[model samples]
Target: MDDNQEASSTKRLWGARFKSEPSAALKALSRSEPSFFRLAPYDLAGSRAHARELQRAGVLDANELAQLLACVDEVEHAFVAGDLHPIEADEDVHTFLERVLTQRLGPIGGKLRAGRSRNDQAANDLKLYLRDKARTLATAIGDVQAALVAQAEQHIDTLSTGFTHLQPAQPIVFAHHLMAHAQAIGRNVDRLIDWDRRSARSPLGAAALAGSAICRSPELSAAELGYDASCENSIDAVAARDHVCEFLFITSMLAVELSRLSEEVVLWSSRQFQWVVLDDGYCTGSSIMPQKKNPDIAELSRGKAGRLIGNLVSMLSALKSLPLAYNRDLAEDKSAAFDSIDTLSLVLPAMAGMIRTMRVDVDQLRRHAPLGFTLATEVADWLALSGVPFSEAHEITGALVKFCEAQDIELGALTPAMLAEVDARLTPEVLKHLTLEAAIGARTGQGGTAPARVAEQIARLKAVLDKQAAWAADYRGPRC
Candidate 1:
């Protein structure tokens, strides 16, 4: 081919309607190859499906369909192997792939664009990409849940302080605290699964707002691409990005949960708490300090939550006040979604490893479980159970705590005379309930810190993880 022929072939997809080529500034400002090229495999998968639809519509013969499908397969393999890329003249994945196809099959490949537009193509590719990614994220979330369950099972009878407003409020089994994080993670998985249900619809046949007359059967393409159903409205199909917004929200919530767990790991590993020991592999050392180990993984996870949240906000802002059918502004969605996916990919594995390897200071937790007059609640409950009005019992318990604070003694140190002086109803029997063992055991209600209840909670969360594992394992789709 001559230089002029090669240059003409590299021109934009719709240049025939205009007298001149687009300005360099417009091309530079409108380029999306860097962000959307990753969707090449999905785009090829959609192309193959659309190829069959073309054959059904008589736009292509059986031989042309065969050739087109084969060429699409080649393009996909080259892309996956990193042998294909967009040139300086290509604007997006669609332009680059179409250019490659036209160069290979000449005019036969041009028939593939008969009933398709970049608007529907872009929407379809993102759905396919996120559908596959959601499965991966569910599995990753399960890995973190497995780490939490392992720690919880190992510490079922272990004692720890339960706090309200960051102040010691009661005694609880350590497993209960770990299971709290597991519960939050389980909800995240549920949200992801629910999000997939709405996102599984296909927009491929919507073709720039109105339904395609040439390829009148979108159901065939939808089924071929593993979508649950074809979209009900063509304009809504290409214009709506609420699915992306929902995805951002779901992932942002997951990041928020990881951040909360990370904060606790940071605090518990500090010298002030000394309740957790960081594994060397998961921790970082300071340059200047001779003795410093930092929970950098946890800190990074916490920081990345803000980034995920910003991605959600940015996508929402981009979608605001845009007209229907399709707009250039929708291009902003790719970067935000891709960034969230990338951030979670980096964070989930590190979080699972850090939790799985870190050592909990069981002895320290046990030693401090009964400090800060944590048993005062048991005394109040005892009085409430002994026919004393709860209001009166609360006052009496406050007085006992104040007296103990002045005397600089624990609840166990109070004598019968001192208890009587504080409350005439304070019999020797009240002392029996003050023990830490009794304090933890008394919480026998469902979802409580008692050993039996903690055991039940573990079993419940494990059942949830098992279902998520099965869902991820059983997922089947047209993946490249």
Candidate 2:
């Protein structure tokens, strides 16, 4: 048959109840082929498993089931190789697959639709697709974390000014700052693993909002398709979209973490900071300005975070008011989710490359580490350790900083006479603790920015990353 004839044959799927054909406007408005066509492989996979269930229940005899399975495998191969595609009349992946199956098997192909509805089929296909994508995303996040850990190891002793309110607050090891981002990303991977466990249940047997009479064994299909179990309630199986929303939430959080790290990349690469230099391959130049080499990867990463957040909001809004069973509004979930998956797939690798290639300015970082009187806190600590009340010690440190600021000298530049003038408590011994090395070394407590502590933190982070890698590998094994 011609393309039009084949498409018209499929259009009769729901035509018996209607007196006339659906209007052109309704057809155009209801079409979801573009957003959901990518679910074709997953739909076919579910079909093969459902076919086994049908055969077990005597809905299709052994010979007919064999023919159905072979045809499904052919359609799946054609779809993957780009030899098959949905025509304009195909409303979604389900309709397109059914049309192809019918064309291959004649009347027997229609029998596969006996115990299911588009409602449960779409739900099953989406869960399978997202479960696979989640594994891929977790693996990509591990790449970014690996880049950060490698950089942190290289800068274990490099000193930089740690900031609060964008002003220097203290001296810190540069590795400590990089590892902080790595820690945040590790948490994002944890969220993905947790979400996968909760969403692994199959919705295949939950046909049309009520239990199916023809196909009695949802558990058989669930096991065949590698699900944890069949869903407990058919209505909840078809209507609930919390899994999609949760995936969006996880990706939104992942984007925000990348954006935070990207903002720092932008700031550090600027002339004012000079703390980092971007590799030429990862940066972009202006059309007219010869001196312009911008950190475009970082900038784009920051901008894409807003799109992820918007996708999460859109998914949540679409789900807030819908009643039980299935509704047409569920179609709105795919585009938002697909856009998030696509956005992250593009952004994650670019970020990993940018981070892996950048150069750090160790001299620049050291020069500014002690410039803002960052050793004032150390001096106060010394006074407190000497039996002075911390409140009084804070007052003494403030007075000393004020005196140095008026004289236009840094904390390290003060003389013994200057110490005596500020306070009798500020003896010559106080200057010993004022060095950048001493300041960084003093914070040797757990999770501190001290060199030894930062090294320990990196080792711990590496252990967690190794665990995350194993999880991703297992998740992508045979079931996926």
Candidate 3:
């Protein structure tokens, strides 16, 4: 074909409203086929919905509809088999797939676009893409959480110091400290599940920038495609990217949580702390230094969180200036989003592996865990329970701690005579609560760092995760 004929063939797929050819730079910049091909399964899902809708609207006979659907299936198979190559001439995945379908089925394939447009087509593809991604991410989060719970279960009785403002504030089981991470990850998983539900609405049939004149049933398409409902307004359907924004926001939040956990890992693995030893598989040796097992992965995971946040901010900024209906500026949406998703994909699995393989030194943890008067609060709590007012109890505990500090004595090491010197109310029974185990055990309230409470919370979280796993398995279907 000649240049003009080739251009006409490509432009014909775009519709007849344009009178002049787009500049080469504009066409080059406008391409989304490369990225869309990376998301071929999602495009195929949207194609399946569009083809069924066309068949329902009498645009194609049963045989033609079957042929078109079969062609779409062929395209997906080609993609999976590595035979499908996205062409540079194709503007986007939606256009590229339609071009391929037209080539395979001729005139019948052309009918698949009867009540569809790139506006709605792109929207639907993104929704399906996020649904699958969100579900996968939720599972990944669950895996990390499981690792955390396993660590907590193994160390439930191991005493450790819990910190507030970087200072030891109280005694807790090592398992309780680990369970806090699990709870944070569990909440992140919940966000992903909620995002999937919010993103379940189909955006099909919102042709070009408005509702199609053809009697296409988006609701039927939605049902067939496993969506909860169809979008109500075409303009808003095409213009809205809130679903994508929400997914990225949840991802950003996850990244923040991961960063916090990573920071802890980095600190714990450092020479200063020596509280844990990361697996050789998860740590790197220094180039010139003989004594370095660097927590580089943790640092990288922590650093990437800023990038995820920047991605969310960039997309929000891009959307901020755009007018109603589709705009070219919206094309900037996928890069940052795709980058953030890719970063998290790598970070989460690596972090999970790191956690699963790392070894915690209970002796070292205990040695450092009890420093800086971690049991001070327990002393105050004990005093209060023994008929002293809380304010007075706190003052007495503070003064006793100061006296112990001057004498180089731990709270547990204080003799009854020394204890009685600080307060006449001090008794043998009160000293029992001064022990780390007793202090932690005494905090049996809901959400406390007591072993029993942490165990209960873990079971509840496990049940929630088990249900999510089953739902995710069903979501993945027989392919899983």
Candidate 4:
């Protein structure tokens, strides 16, 4: 068929002026396109608002506007209640809904598209969708942070060996380390709240690339859609995807933080560490080995983080070279945008569950806390407090550590005579800094891992989390 006949053969929403319909493979790609499907709810909202404006402008009488809103509501209700499905010829959600409305409401339904284009409408839908999803993700992160805080409070005085480069370095409690993850999650919560506020601007009136001079007031549409303001310029409104990029970055960073905690879960549950035991409900058994119970939840979360990072990279790559104004390329942006939110939504709750259920082996923690001469720093600090030059004290502590290692004894296992062999500064009084408890207790500086400091941290974190909870709740809170 010739181009005009070809275009006429399968009628698309943007089919006019096109000589031929897109190639079959290209046309089929629309079904997989997520932008329109996800935008349906917001698109209906925009149409109702647009219809009222058209009536005010005398394009539609009051009866026509009322009829349009009633039809829009019917389509929305059917879609939500699972009673509506588009026909096979429907190419995209925008066209599908418009087709359904046109079929039911006759010519008046076609009048609804007089001053708007899919360009601005899709952008509007995206902002609405992400603003709501960001709030949900923030609340999930807060839940995970709360789990960590609750666990930390339980372990405020439980001592464990803190590692540097996977080797024992000093003594700290389980509460201090877990709360570090909670603090990181708190930042993620902040980012989501911050980004949601910044991204709530509306782009509905930016029809096509520029705008229609006679369209309804964008301010009114924006207010109805819950946006803080309308986009200042039409071009930037539809053309900009920086908000999408920033959201992807936030979710990707959140995944990385969760992966770090997952790694710890894997390590702590292992035979060598024995620091924690995962609940049977959250773990899986090996297929071939009857004796094996694995940390699959943590392992899977760690693997999924790579996918989240890849999604951010894909989103950035999609937008990097697109020219000004909207492009066909942007249709691909939805997958990563949606997937990042989904991935974090799934991972955060799993992490929170694991944190809530794990058993901490206190005896193992205390026993391991003093192993590998982890208290060398404490002995050096004691010498420094005894009025010795820190450099000399450091050397003296090193000598003591070496002497202990030569005899195959820990720093705390050495006697007064054995201590004197290393240096005169290594007195029986130095024994005060030798136990894991004393080593942990001696450091009472702010932000230290000392038991008292950890208690203070528990209080501070609760305050931060309670404030974050309020914001996340507000973003998705109750009406009125």
> Over 4 Å off in model 4, which ranges?
1-11, 34-36, 476-480
- Whose TM-score is higher: candidate 2's or candidate 3's? 2
Better of 3 and 4 by lDDT: 4
* lDDT (10s digit) by residue, model 3, range 1-480: 221224346534764788787788988877773555666677787777777777677787789878887888888888778887766677887776777777778888677777778778777777777777777788888888988888888897788888889888888888888888888877877787777777777888788778877636888878767788888888988898877788889899999999999999998898888888999999898889998899888999999999999989988988987888998677666776678778989998999999999999999887866688888888888788778999999999898999899999888788888888887777666777777778888889999878888888878878887987876766631121
lDDT of 1 by residue, 1-480 (tens): 221234346857677888776888998898884867999899998998899998999999999999999989888888788877777777888888888888888888789899989999999999899888888999999999999999999999999999888899899989999999989977888988899888888998899889788888898888888888899999999999999999999999999999999999999999999999989999999999969999999999999999999999999999999988799899888999999999999999999999999899999999889899999999999999999999999999999999999999999888899898887999989998988889999999988899999999899888889999998776655654
What are the per-residue Cα lDDT tens digits for candidate 4 across 6-52? 22333477768888757878768766454347667767887877787
* TM-score-best of 1 and 3: 1
- On a 0 to 100 scale, what is the lDDT of residue 313 in model 4? 89
Instruction: State how far residue 245 of model 2 sits from its true place (Å).
Output: 0.7
**Model 2, span 154-200: residue lDDT tens:** 99999999989988889999999999999997799999999989997
Q: What TM-score does each of the candidates earn?
A: 0.97, 0.97, 0.94, 0.93
Worst 10 residues of 1 by lDDT: 1-10
- CA displacement after TM-score superposition, residue 308 of candidate 3 (Å): 0.8
Clash counts for the predictions, in order:
0, 0, 0, 1
The order by descending TM-score is 1, 2, 3, 4
